[model samples]
Target chain A: MADMRTPLSRARGLGSAKKGTEHFWMQRVTALANIPLMMFLVGALVVHAGSDYTTMTGFLGNPFIGVVMLLLIFSACYHMRLGLQVVIEDYIHGEATKLLALIANQFFTLTIAVACALAVAKLVIG
Target chain B: MSEQSKPARPLSPHIQIYRWTLTMMLSILHRATGVALYAGTALLAWWLLAAASGPDAYALVQEVSSAWYGRLVLFGYTWGLFHHMMGGIRHFIWDTGRGFDLKHVEIIARITAFLPPVMTLGVWLAAYIYPGAL
Candidate 1:
């Protein structure tokens, strides 16, 4: 098996697109970040539940909460993008279709991140 | 040049052959939960936009989200978040190339499946039991 050689293999770049390890690493990194962020988010929501919009806004307006939320938004968007990219790659067979879906995933995730950031800013600065 | 005809080789060990194990079920559920979370992100955006637009817009969002349909969707989102969170942790374990053994794999899968719903139910229960606590 070690001695067997194919000329095409030497010419071909990294096999399997060389993407698996990066995805695996990013997923773990996000997972670690989410451990604290998720706990904070759930606690924040529970604490603010049943409050009016003003109250909720005020809670989020706190600098500490605002920063934690920024972390959460960034990590969640990154993780979501990675997860959906794989899903699109697996399910969408056509190269053009897959590219479109991947683009859509990035667009949507970025939109969510920006929207969440603006909302946080409104609460904090406004 | 003559092209030699060769008999087709059978594919080995496909998804259909196995008695589905816990890890297999969890693997598929992770993807399903991921898709669910993707939809939930849209709802989060809607909530944020509503919050940013001030009282009138926020009120409208509140009205829609406070209704029965809204609660149902929130419940689904809550469960999706929990399930996906646990599934992510499982993936983290696998990322290190650990926990591939049969017993640990099944244990983690079972925990992932059961833990999220329990946590969601607990949170919802607290919401109902002590409505003003938050």
Candidate 2:
């Protein structure tokens, strides 16, 4: 039999179909970023729990809280997109369904990002 | 490459023939927990947008969330978050190409599956035991 090492070594340079490590690393990076943000977010929500709209609005309107909320939302949506993309790839069988699902996932996540950004901008800048 | 001349290769053991293991169960549960978390994010978005819209909208959200079904949803969301977080740590360990030994892998999988539910219950119990303390 021909040596297996030559073909195996040559294949290493071609890289993974999806450029593998990027997704893995991004998932970890976002997961780490979320640790603190998740704590702050839950704490913030608890603090605002019984507050009325005016009170809550004023709280969110604060520049610091607004920016933090914006960051949390964007990072979360990005993290979610990455995670769901993997799930879809694993479960969705047909090529067409997978492609469509991927497109929808990106569209939905991007819409959330834009809407969240706009809401925060209005709160902080208005 | 002749059709009749091709060799019959020896086959390796596969998952179908092997008994299910703790590690296998945890691997599937991790994906399930991830899907649950994805749904929870939609709820978060709704809460945020409702808060942004004003009093009436915010009140709508509060009313729903304070209801029995809403509380159940929130409970599930909390469970999903903690479960997925632990699973992610397990994945991180796996990513480093360590911890795949027979004994340690099963132990870690079992721990990941059990720890999150305990933590979730602990948090809720505390919230009830001392509402003010939380």
TM per candidate, chain B? 0.82, 0.78
Per-candidate DockQ vs. reference:
0.51, 0.33
Q: Candidate 2's error at B105, in angstroms?
A: 1.9
Interface RMSD of each: 1.9, 3.3
| Candidate 1 structure quality by residue, lDDT tens digits, A40-85 | 8777666656779888777878888889988898998998898888
Q: TM-scores across all candidates? A: 0.84, 0.79
Candidate 1: residue B22 Cα off by (Å): 2.7
How does each model score on lDDT? 0.82, 0.78
lDDT, candidate 1, at B52: 70
Q: State which candidate has the highest TM-score.
A: 1
Clashing residue pairs, backbone N/CA/C < 3 A, model 2: none
Local accuracy of candidate 2 as per-residue lDDT tens digits, B83-102: 77888888888888999898
Q: Clash totals for all models, in order?
A: 0, 0
Segments of candidate 2 deviating more than 4 angstroms: A1-20, B1-18, B126-134
Model 1 agreement with the true structure over B25-51: per-residue lDDT tens digits: 887888898898877877777777787
